[model samples]
Target: MNDADPLPDLDPLVPSTARVYDALLGGRDHFKPDREAADVFLSMVPHAREAALVNRDAFLRGVQYMVREAGIDQILDIGCGLLTKQRTHEVAQEIDPEVRVVYVDKDPMALTHGRALIDTGQTTTVVTGDLRDPSGILAHPQVRAGLDFERPIGLIVWMLMQVAEAEDPDGIVATLMAPLASGSHLFIVTWPDTGDPAQRALSQACLETLGNGWARPVDRVLKHFQGMPMVEPGLEFVPRWYPGDPGREVPSAEDLKPFERTQIAGIAVKP
Candidate 1:
């Protein structure tokens, strides 16, 4: 069997991808190298920080909605970044006590820290697995321990796909969602290609360089939900999905211009 590549070290001097995201979200686990690289990212996509924060907000909202509103008891959070104080399980179980959450990340450090952040007496768990191999994560002990696949599970793939290459993203998502029955739903958020040439080019290049460089157009993104039924708001900007009263809404895609840069969000159910 071909084992996956080992996770990176705690070399704060290297400025890892997750640490860069941590810096963007105002987290403290990063160092000078991460800060420097993040600064470069900001310069390339000016609103990169804002987009990260907005994306976090969307993640919290999605978990809350699924747990409280959708009655989803099982949740699998893929590519979950550094498990800081603000955790998905912390947010979701607050609404429904029986909620089960499994945090999956290819980073070994993330696995250690995420397990640490798991509150005692809670159903939350963590595992080291890559998104490219969805079933491996599903078969992980932590995933099996916390979740029941026979029931509907809410799959949260937040702000993670932009880091995946184009040739296989849709196929990857399909594989992940394939396990769930008809009621299972998937939530995905990503940086989209805006009509603004300058913003689009800058955002594309930055993601391409830092991430996997495969940000897709909205059309390609919609293709991810090819056989699913969309929720009320459908797939759109991350900030626009069922925002609270007087929420932020971009009337048109153009109106959804990047504040320097912006990310997109979508939710669809398996038919």
Candidate 2:
């Protein structure tokens, strides 16, 4: 029932990855720098906006499956960006109204906006935390209280590993899941290593310009799920995981032409 903690400072000049993502999703909380950065990405791949939506769809579908099929009720959404119409809590709660969700993000803006737009009751809450500090995040008051680590929980990491290298992503994943009892699940949705040359160039451009973002092959992504047992339909193009589901429709070959290799997603459960 407590309010979300105060967020850190906001740096407008620096192009925020979160804001750029928000802009890509047609969200209204971005600044000039975010738009400029997003435009740079669009210049390389005009379908970047479509790609973003595809990723969102994949994320929502993954959460829905976890809640409805996996029988999970607690979720930890790491690196959750600005508010969106179909957020993690929204999707999970739709399946199970009592589902408890804890939204975590390093961005101060995300924390502030999440409280205002996402958190509506005791079942959901927002906290300011960094991906680099997985231990801290797991130990946060909100996370500790909102979730029962002794039971199963869903951990959502959408496009976050691309930003982490020092922590040995596999190690980070292990560290984060160590506290949770067996049966917990982790969902990872991120840029795929395979894509059009133009798409690769655009990804590099964003890295050079905004100093964030990276893409890895599916094999590399699987490494992060090392100890966890793969959920059915192991790593594949995000849309391919659970195709034809309401929010997770797999586009026709023609509709997927422009973004066929844009993103990859998978879910794995702790043994």
State which candidate has the highest TM-score.
2
- What lDDT score is found at residue 257 in candidate 2? 56
Q: Which regions of candidate 1 deviate over 4 angstroms? A: 1-13, 119-122, 163-167, 198-202, 205-211, 243-257
Q: What is the per-residue lDDT of model 2 for residues 1-271, given as tens digits with 9 covering 90 to 100?
A: 1444567789988878789989988888889998998998888888788888877887877888899999999999898988667877888888899999998887877877888877765888888888878898988887898899889989987556456576567777778888887899988887667645744765685786577667776677788887567776778776576822435455653355556577777888888
Provide TM-scores for the models.
Answer: 0.86, 0.91
Task: Give the per-residue Cα lDDT of candidate 2 at 166.
Answer: 66
Error of 2 at 132 (Å): 0.8
> What C-alpha lDDT values do all the predictions have?
0.71, 0.79
- Candidate 2 C-alpha error for residue 160, in Å: 2.8
CA error at residue 173 for candidate 2, angstroms: 1.1
- Model 1: lDDT equals 0.71
